[model samples]
Target: MTWNWDQPDWPKFSYKSEALVPLEQQFLLQSGEFVGACKHMGADDQETLKIELISEEAVKTSEIEGKLLNRDSVQSSLRHQLGLGAERPGIDPAERGISEMMVDLYRNFGDSLDDATMFTWHRMLLSGDREIGAIGGYRTHAEPMQVVSGPDYKRSVHFEAPPASRMNDEMTRFIAWFNDTSPGGKTPLPPLTRAGIAHLYFVCIHPFEDGNGRIGRALAEKSLAQNLNRPSLIALAYTIERKRKDYYAALERNNKELEITAWLTYFASTILEAQRNTIARVDFFVAKAKFYETFRDQLNGRQEKVIARMFKEGIDGFKGGLSADNYITIGKTSRATATRDLQDLVEKGALTRTGELRHTRYHLSLAIQSTA
Candidate 1:
């Protein structure tokens, strides 16, 4: 029945320095490259990229916990927070709440970690969920909390957090380590490695009745942002979502041991992969700049919007190229208008058409090959 926190050496988490060195180097290199790439972007483009990255993180982090949020709603909320635009429809209280938390974390990345901050984040995360009842700070109930899978008849517990009675004390210790910047303190740990440890520690603490996973992930991101001294361009949540099986397995495997070398290795590797994925986005930004310069005046507003979205989102933005239906949706034009606009793009050499008649799809022409 003993969990990781029950170990005699609990809270003294350690990792293999040799294993983490290369991973750490790769992460720092990729992160620096992303930052350098971002520096070349204009202010507006930088803001757009920020919105895209944060929105993806917000949506994917919730998705990991089986909560599917509307990406548009989340994006709209974020845009409103960043003062980029007015709020859009479909932004429920939950969406707004998540947006506020995300924006706060990014904007105040260097704020000292404290109990008040943690409680505020928890309250915001569950603000309008009546079923979850009052967001009365952390869980104080003595009931056991376990992360389980499957039906009750055949449920399996993947991890068990420390008892509720131990949460406050545990968190105090964690916050001290988090805020300590002295060289002799926890600063010897690489920033990214420290971030990984913070993630595992917070999740193990499981302080809240709900939303612990999301909050933990946010804390991890905050750690990275504070360390990097900038808003994060890399979204580790996206990589975790893509490799969810390994993500959960890493957690479960480490939950049973005091030494967290495996978890640290997995965490570093995931971050490195996330940063590598972001490099493609950096290239896309460069490509987009060239694309706009070459064809900005050739396309109408609708075509410009669609092409910009395709360029920013890359391959995952649309599958099999842009279709009339998708164009209609994204461009907010009638079917006939969308078709006409698409045809105009084709004629202008901004798009290339495939298939025949109703089956046709439009892809960016040689003038702008998609980098996503």
Candidate 2:
């Protein structure tokens, strides 16, 4: 059960570069399309999108690590950090911390990766976390860093990272390799290949005592952004969160070997899926603008409030498709008014109604469907 870190080749990873060519091309095309699609978005839409995408990555990446954060709080923290919205008091520490890290990542996507940068991100990510013994630095404990599952009595060691004693050397090599493979470096790699390999290589090192997974995903995004010469505008963690099981399976399967074509292939496909998801989301933003333009003058205040609440839930609309009772609650109106307003929305083609009577539900007739 030796890991790749224990092999003679050690950090020198090998892969079938030719196999990733098609995916690389697809990623390039979709990235261009994604950027072009974003240009069509209105100023307000673009701002909403920037907050939405970054907060979504923060929330989803945390969720992947079994940390359930309030999405709204995270979004609020991000808005304040990005200077797009007013800073509200009593923000949760976890929310504020991750938001700061994400804002830093987004703002400095093209900066070189170094120990100072990694430490800054680490400190920002675990700002208020009290459980980790070593904050903002590499792990220094004597015990092994084993990624295990199941209860203590029947635990399974899925993967074990290099010991803390090798932290300085391992991290130095990792950083050098990361920079050397960047867009204009000594051994430049393509977008998806560099991103995929960067993610796997960093996670394998497992440099930090905590926040490795989140930081690893951030490195993947940064790699893409560097190659593309801008923020990649892809919801990588969002897409990976949906396919979490497959994501873990891919990493686990490749942990024992260095020829990581399978891992790269999986990651490339995931990047493509993420690109399509982001493009659809951008399209939805465009559709939303058009929707409001058409109905902005048509809806009353109550109807507008209900619609805004639904939009806040994101591309899926309201969770249960906005029932009459839900609308009444959101609109703060009586049953009759709720019914009338809902009917008006449907009649004007702003919403599509389904079910009937007590089982009735209404959904936005937006042009885009769920990315799932």
**Candidate with maximal lDDT:** 2
* Clash count in backbone of candidate 1: 0
For every candidate structure, what is the RMSD over all alpha carbons to the true structure, in angstroms?
3.4, 1.7
Clashes of each: 0, 0
In model 1, the Cα lDDT at residue 21 comes to: 88
Candidate 2 has an lDDT of: 0.90
Scored against the true structure, residue 317 in model 1 reaches a CA lDDT of 50
Model 1, range 268-296, lDDT digits (tens) per residue? 88877777767666666566677678886
Model 1 worst lDDT run, 10 consecutive residues: 363-372
lDDT of 2 at 3: 99
Question: Per-residue alpha-carbon lDDT of model 2 for 1-372, expressed as tens digits?
Answer: 899999999877899889999999999888888888888877887988988888888999999999889888998999888887886777788889899999998899998889999998899889899899988899999899989999999999999999999999999998999999998899999999999989998998898889999999999999999999988768899999998999999999999998999999999999999999888888787888889998978999999999999888777677778899999899999999998999899999999999988989999888864353
**C-alpha lDDT values of all predictions:** 0.80, 0.90
lDDT of 2 at 178: 90
Model 1 per-residue lDDT at 114: 88
Provide the lDDT at 63 for model 1.
88
* Model 1 TM-score, all chains together: 0.86
